[model samples]
Target: MALIGIARLASESELLEAKSRVTYFEIAARRILNRTKPNMPFQWTINPYRGCEFGCKYCYARYTHEYMELDVQDFEDKIYAKPAAADRVRLELRRIDRKDHIAIGTATDPYQPAERRFGRTRSILEAFARERGRHLGITTKSDLIVRDLELLREIARANVLSINITITTLDEKLARLMEPRAPRPALRLKAVRQLAQAGLVVGVFPNPIMPLLTDSERALDRLARRARDAGAQYFGAGPLFLMPCAQKVLLPWLEDNFPALALDYRKLFEHSAYLGSGAKRILRARVEKIRDRYGLNSGPLEYRPELWLGEEQASFELRD
Candidate 1:
C-alpha cells in the first residue's frame, strides 16, 4: 500500500524486535514536545512512543495510530519507539516557558512495556532532570516506572514534578479483561507507594471509570481508600469517553464480557465521546465523596520544590 507522511516513516522504520503478537520499530524523532490546545490544564505534551503495548480495550488513544494510516486494531500490535527522544526533548525544552506545565504520556503511556527495551521514557526524564524550574507531570499505567526512581528524584529536586498512576480496578479478572497487557493493579499501587515515599508529588487516578461496570460508589470508594492507604496524596477519576476508534474495540469486548451493558454503551457513546453532563455530575460527586471519605486531595498536592528556579510556583489544575 502507498503510504505518506508519518505512515511512510513508519513503514520505513527499522524493525527493532517482535514478541508474541507485538512488533517494535525504531523511528527517528522529528519533534518530542507538542503544544496542547488552549484551555487545557497543561501547555505542552510529550509521548515517547507512537503506540502503547498495554492494549487497553477502552483506550481513546487508539485513534492516534490512524494518523499513520494504520488500522486502530494495529495500535497495540505495532509499537514505534523514538530513538532520539532525549536529545529532542532537551532541544524542545529550550523553547518552552518554565512556568508552563509539560505533561508526559498524555496520549501514550511513557512507561509502556516497550519502555523496558527502548528506555525512551527514561531518556526523556534524564533530559528533564538537567533542567530547572519546569512544571512536569507524568501519567502511566505501568509499575516499571519505579525502575527509574533515582532519575525521578533528580528531576523532582530541580523541577515541579507530579506523577499520576492509573489503576482502574482492584479486581484482577476484570483488569485482565480491560487492560490485558498493562501492569496489575496491585503493582501499580506499589509504584504509587514508592513514589510517594520518595517524596514525589504523586496521585492515583482511576481514569475512564467505566459506567455500569467500574463506576459504582462501592468500586470507587475501595480504590480511593486503597490509594490513601498506599500514601497517595490525591485521588481522581473520570468516566469513560469513547471515540470511534475506542468504540470499535470496547463495544465488542463489552458484548463478549458484559453482554447487558453492550447495547447501552453503543447508545451512550453513539453521538459524543463524553458522557452526558448529568452523568458527569453524578460521577464527579461520587469521586469527590470517595476522596473526602479517604481524606485525599482531588488532585496533585500544591508543592514547590526547594530547587525551583521559576519566578513563582507553577499551579497545575487537575484535568479529567
Candidate 2:
C-alpha cells in the first residue's frame, strides 16, 4: 500500500532493535516541538518516541498508531525513537516565546524502554539544561527518570521544571493488573522521594482514577498520604476518560478481571469520554479533602528557580 505523512516515515525508518514481540525503529523527525491548543494548560508539547512499552490497558494514546496506518495494538509493540533529538529541540527553541510552557511526553512516555537504548529523552533534557529560561514538565510512570538526577537538577536550576509521576494505586497487585509492563508502585514512589530530595519540584498524580475500581475514597486517601510521605509537594487526580480506541482494549480487560464492574463501565462510557458532572464533582471533593489532610498542594507548585537568568520576572503556576 502507498503511504504518506507519518506512515511513510514509519515505513522508511531504520530498524534499531527487536526483542520478542517488541521492535524498535529510528525515525528522523522534521521538528521536535508542537504548539498545543489554546485551551490546553500548556503551550507546547514534545514526545521523544512514537509509542510506549508499558502497556497500560487504559491508555488513551493507542490511537496515535493509527496515524501510521498500523493497528492500535502496535502502539506498544512498535516503538519509534527520534535521533538527533537534542539538536532538533535546540533549533526549534527560537520559534516559541520564552514564557510558553513545554510539556514533554504528552502523547508518549519520553523515558520508555526505547529511551534506554536510544537516549532520546536524555538528549532532549540535556538540550533543555543549556537554556536559561523556559517552563518545562515531564510525566512518566518509570523510575528510570532517577537515572538523570544531576541532569534534571541542572535543568531545574535554570528553568521552572515540574516532574509529575503517575501512580494510579499503591496496591501492587492492582498496579500490575492495570499497567502490565510498568514499574512497581514502590519503585515509582522511591523515585519521587529521590527526586524531591534533590530539590526538584515533584508531584504525584493518581490519574485516570478508574471508576468502580480505584475511585474509592479509601484508595485515593491512602495514595495522597503516601505521596506526601514520599516528599511529594502536590497531589492531584482526574477521573478516567475512555475514547473508542482505549475502550477496545480496556473493555475486554475489564470484563476478564472485574466481571462485576464490566456492565457499569460500559454504561458510564457509552455516552461520553468524560465522567458526568455530578460524578466528577464528587471525585474532586474526595481528592481535595485528601489533599488538605495530607498537607499537599492541589496542583503544580508555583516556583521560580533561584538560578533562572531570564529577564521575565514572574512566578509561574505550572500545570499540565
Candidate 3:
C-alpha cells in the first residue's frame, strides 16, 4: 500500500479498538537513518518511531503527520513503529563515515511509552553497541532510557555517546500544563542524575522555552540550578518555535490557560515560526548566565574516540 493509504488504515483501525486513547501500528520502513538538513549540528538522525505519545502542547514535529496525509492530531494519537529498524540501521551505518554524528530521537521520542512494547530503540542501541568510534547522541524526556543502561554503557565504551534529557521547567504544575502526558519534571531530573551516575555524559535541554511561561530569568535559572544539582554536565535552551501545525494546538491551549499571552503569541509568531532575533538573544543570554553560574557547559560536549582520530587525520591529510 502507499504511505498515505497505510496512514489512513492505521488511523481507522483505532476506531474499532475499545481500549486506550492511543493506537500502535507496525510498518516496514524503507530507511531509518535520515540525513539532517544542511547547517544542522548533527549530520544524521534516527527516529525508531513515527509520532509521539507524550503529546506536548508545543510539539513542533506535528508536521510529520502531514506527509502521510494525516491530521496534525494524528501525530499523537497514531504511533507507527518501524520493524527491522535495527537491521536497517546497521546497514545504513556502513554508508556513514565514523566522523559523522548520528542523533537518535530527533523527531520522535525513541523511548516514549511505545518503546515498552516495541523495544525498537533498545534494538537500535544493541546495533550501535557492536560498532566502534562513531558519534552517537540520544535525546528524550522519558526515564525509560535507564532500562537500557548497560547497552548504552557498552556503546559508550567504543563510541562517543551523549544523552540529552529534555526538561522544560522545574515547576511541576507548569510542566503538567505544557507537557500533559510526558513524564513529570521530577522524574526527568531523577533520570538525569541516574544517567550521569552511570558514568554517561548527560545534558539537560530546556528547548522551546515558551515565552512569558518558561522564559523568565528566574524560571530558567531555577531549572538550570536543579539540573546542575542533578549532576547534569550541560544546560541548553532555545525559544519556542510555533510552526502553523503547532500553533493550531498550542494557541487554543494558551488562550484557555493563558489568555493574556495568547494574543502576544499570535503576534509574535504571526509571520514566522522563529522568535525574533531580539527575543532569542535575550533568552540566550539569560540561559548562558545561568549555565555559567551552575558550572554547566552551553551544550552537550562532543568527543572523538581514539579509533576515529586516525581516520579523521587521514581525511585531513588527503585534503591537505
- Which tens-of-lDDT digit does each residue in 1-320 have in candidate 1? 67765666777889999888999998755567766655567777778888888999998787668767789989899998876556667888998899999888867799998988888889889899899999998999999999999999999999999999999999999999999999999999999999999988899988878898899999889999899988888986767877788888998899999999999998887888878889989988988888888888877522111111111111111122
Q: Which ranges of candidate 2 are over 4 A from the true structure?
A: 301-320
Clashes of each: 0, 0, 0
What lDDT is reached at residue 144 by model 3? 93
Better of 1 and 3 by lDDT: 1
Q: Model-by-model lDDT, in order?
A: 0.82, 0.82, 0.79
The order by descending TM-score is 2, 1, 3
1 or 2, greater by TM-score? 2
Q: Model 1 Cα displacement at 111 (Å)?
A: 1.0
User: Which model is ahead, 1 or 3, in terms of TM-score?
Assistant: 1
Using Cα atoms with residue i matched to residue i, what is each candidate's TM-score against the true structure? 0.91, 0.92, 0.89
Model 1 vs. true fold: TM: 0.91
Off by over 4 Å in 3: 1-19, 301-320
Q: By descending lDDT, how would the candidates be arranged?
A: 2, 1, 3
Candidate 2 local lDDT, 1-320, one digit each (tens): 78776677778889999999899998766667766545456777777888899989988777667777888789999998876567678888978899998888767888788888889899989899999899999989999999999999999999999999989999999999999989999999999999999999999989879998889999999899889999999986778878777899899999999999899999999998777889989988998899889898866622111111111111111122
**Residue-level lDDT tens digits of model 3 in 142-237:** 999999999999999999999999998888998998988899999999999999999999999988688998888988888888999999999867
